[model samples]
Target chain A: MAKRVGMEVSIAVAEAVKLADADVIAAYPITPQTHIVEHLSELVADGELDAAYIPVESEHSAMSSCIGSSAAGARTFTATSSQGLALMNEMIYIAPVLRTPIVLAIANRALSAPINIWNDHSDIMSVRDTGWLSIFAENGQEALDLTLASFRIAEDPAVCLPISMNIDGFTLSHFIEPILMPEKAEVDKFLPPYKPQLWLDIKNPISIGLLGGPECYTEARKATDDALWGAKRVVIKAFDEFNQVFGRQYHVVETYRHEDAETIIVSMGSISETAMTAIDEMRDQGQKIGLVRLRLWRPFPEEEFLAAVSKAKNLAVIDRHMVMGCSSGPVGLEVKSLVYNSGLRPGISNFLLGLGGRDVTRDDFKYIHEKATSGQVQARCEIVGVFE
Target chain B: MTKPTVDAMAKVGDLPMGFTAKPGSTVAFKTGDWRSVRPVLDREKCIYCGFCYFYCPDGVYQDMGKDEKYYKADLDFCKGCGICAHECPKKAITMTLEEV
Candidate 1:
């Protein structure tokens, strides 16, 4: 039985992990991500969740231990934020190469120079090429649902790769929302116990993460990339199965009012909700604008994305991380490259906003629409609402 | 038990998932070719102290028991690191460069 209840998003995420019946949780305390692991620790302490909660000294060790546990055929999980994620950088890259399907919850935060702890995409963007299946959650409900689905998606024999579910720090992570938490039995029906295809077994020994010399290195990397590309099918299947069991539909790319629009805004994470409200207001006034929210970040839902924006003449891409020195932000670069390669010549304008915890209002979305439609937006990435 | 051999020239699809290999697969690769210098032992001067046997990094030197006067290097697995010769107390082993 699934019942709607008001709960913090972090706790909901923890509860979802528990329902997945994770065998091991290795994590270090970091802001925003701290609550998720802390609640997990409590769950383990109270005997609500039967899992090993390893309180690691650092994020690096956290991910390393996760790899070790997951290699030993345990359903392993961990959570981290800005600096924590950066610290786990080394192990993060190796996890995917080793085919350790560890589910990681990222409380998306801005990377630091001045050391600010706020919501942004900087943390996730830094490790974008780490070969992990990356997904974004626009709300608390999506966070919970996606976290649970991540286990099924990652541990699938065809897609034995790590996954990172990114939720905006403080915004979606700290917010208490009415999420329909599914019962354990329902979750069990949705996601069965994890059965690894390959593991570090003592009886039947096998070597993983071995040295890939020049003779086989390229093929090894190609195989990993192929596995990631092949994961899209499994992702869709899992989402479809999840919808069947939970009655909540999810897509790699979700659209809002884009059926008959000339201007479309592209965004990810929690800010898409704000953009949606702005789109509705503009629609009421007959502005012919809409939004395309990317729920799946990695292996970049190509066909779905192009279909979502094919009819649109103008695209306002909202990027939360600034790719310094580059012509555009990370997401912006990806979208532009995708559009260019696909031969779609939509006037894509990259807008950088909500960096290091800056507030992104509906008004900002409207302003972006104005710039995009009026053709006043430049070809380069523009930082919106910077105090001049 | 026989170890499975991975074909180095195998295509991306044919390769094992995650570059995994069976245990002791290194036996298929004779690393002795990588050695620039090979150890020559003086069997008559050898005291059978087992110094070369204990110090060989690759476990290249094998003790032939009480019958043999010195530990013999298994060139099939040896990289000719010279560690066995360097650690020999009786100076029974000497490293010599392989002639081209």
Candidate 2:
């Protein structure tokens, strides 16, 4: 497939919405995510997408509308950033439990106290356990590609959880780039109309979201948990199906020349882009360095992450945010947990970097790469070069 | 005064799975111990920020109608968590749990 030139991240987002053939879009504008929804709303206004562009009063209503639309068996989407995501916090817990395959684009942004509008993991990390299958995108192309991928994974009968597709706030979402938009016909062939085994059927008129007692509550949770566990394979299937259609490959945990490299710096979201740039620059200088990027966050691809790092003698897991009162950084904790379970244990440890929208300069990568190679692994997570 | 029979019992929602807030099960509750003397938000002092509503898991606070200027806390459901009292920014809903 030839690359399409100059489509902004927001427009790439719009293109994905068109490809997914979403039935409804209910979203409120909030910075970075605003552009994505603005483009999507324009697509709706221009008669490009046959969908409802709901100008909702608040992010809560935006998610509520998505829940309502998805329940009616309509393929639904919404995008939000920063405080908008905070506002949607209530419904964040509800959409997945309802098993509505609602895909949302979360342009990752910092939540407020001092009220800054900058790129940070604070917003998405807050909803980490909201039961949505989460994926982070590295660039504009991946953003578009994964938005389409999200639908296939989300609507999979075995994986009926809502999917939140994350693009870094102001990093990828605002950055202009050239990318490929797959032919709508080909995309349609890949993703069929979402047929949820559970939906609101007017003619049949079945009950949805019934209040369960102690007896059924556990079953409801088990159903969603089982579906998530089931999603592990369904995600691979969806990726395999996509790869067959296009020559592109999708890995839950993507490796960029990570094989056999003794030391690698690992992170997610836009930090992966910086990490790769570091890899390219260092590799050109004859340094045997590599990188691993976690594209999928939820359904935490533990087995795949282990395989990616198996050959490495040294590995540094970089987290973009803090877990607050703990010995763990959020991503660092997950990586450590996976290592603890894997048992095959290469020389793996954790590092905290690029928190609260602090820029991870190319020089910063050089520092982290050095930390990866400096012999002794921290018995636990280390704050990599972050000034105390 | 006449008491309603079991056959004539009025119910609200459908029975979910098992017992609910039933009349005489051993599920202990300290409804009496849960009482507090928080200042009923004089609606006049209410800005309707809705913080009280969000903080209340018991659905204790709700607006009665469209014209309702401020939400009133439902004393029936209020478990006296005092979360609302502590979180109230305007110091409007005060706690008098202790007597002056």
Using lDDT, give the best candidate's number: 1
What tens digits encode model 2's per-residue C-alpha lDDT throughout A1-388?
Answer: 4457887797798789888999999999998788888888888999989999999999999999998888888999999987998899999987776788899999898878768788888788888877789999889988988899999999887787899999988888888998887887789878998886566665544445544445445555655666666687887888889888876788888999888587777788888877888888988888778888888888788888888888777777877666767776777777777777777566666777665567887777787777767777676677766666
Scored against the true structure, residue A117 in model 1 reaches a CA lDDT of 95
Report the TM-score of candidate 2, chain B only: 0.56
TM-score of chain B of each: 0.85, 0.56
After superposition, the stretches of candidate 2 with alpha carbons farther than 4 Å from their true spots are A1-3, A284-286, A379-388, B1-100
* Model 2 lDDT on a 0 to 1 scale: 0.77
Provide the overall lDDT of each model, using Cα atoms, as 2-decimal numbers: 0.91, 0.77
Q: Pick the DockQ winner.
A: 1
Q: After superposition, how far is residue A357 of candidate 2 from its true place, in Å?
A: 2.5
By summed lDDT, the worst window of 10 consecutive residues in model 2 chain B runs over B1-10
Model 1 per-residue lDDT tens digits across residues A179-204? 99999899999998889878888898
Clashing pairs in 1: none
Model 2 TM-score is 0.77
Candidate 1 chain A: 10-residue stretch with minimal lDDT: A208-217
TM-score for candidate 1: 0.97
lDDT of 2 by residue, B30-96 (tens): 2333565754675667777888888876766887656786778766557677788677787788756
Q: What is the interface RMSD of candidate 1, in Å?
A: 1.7
Model 1 Cα lDDT, one tens digit per residue, B7-93? 566577777776788887767876687778889998888999999889887887787887765688988877878888888887888
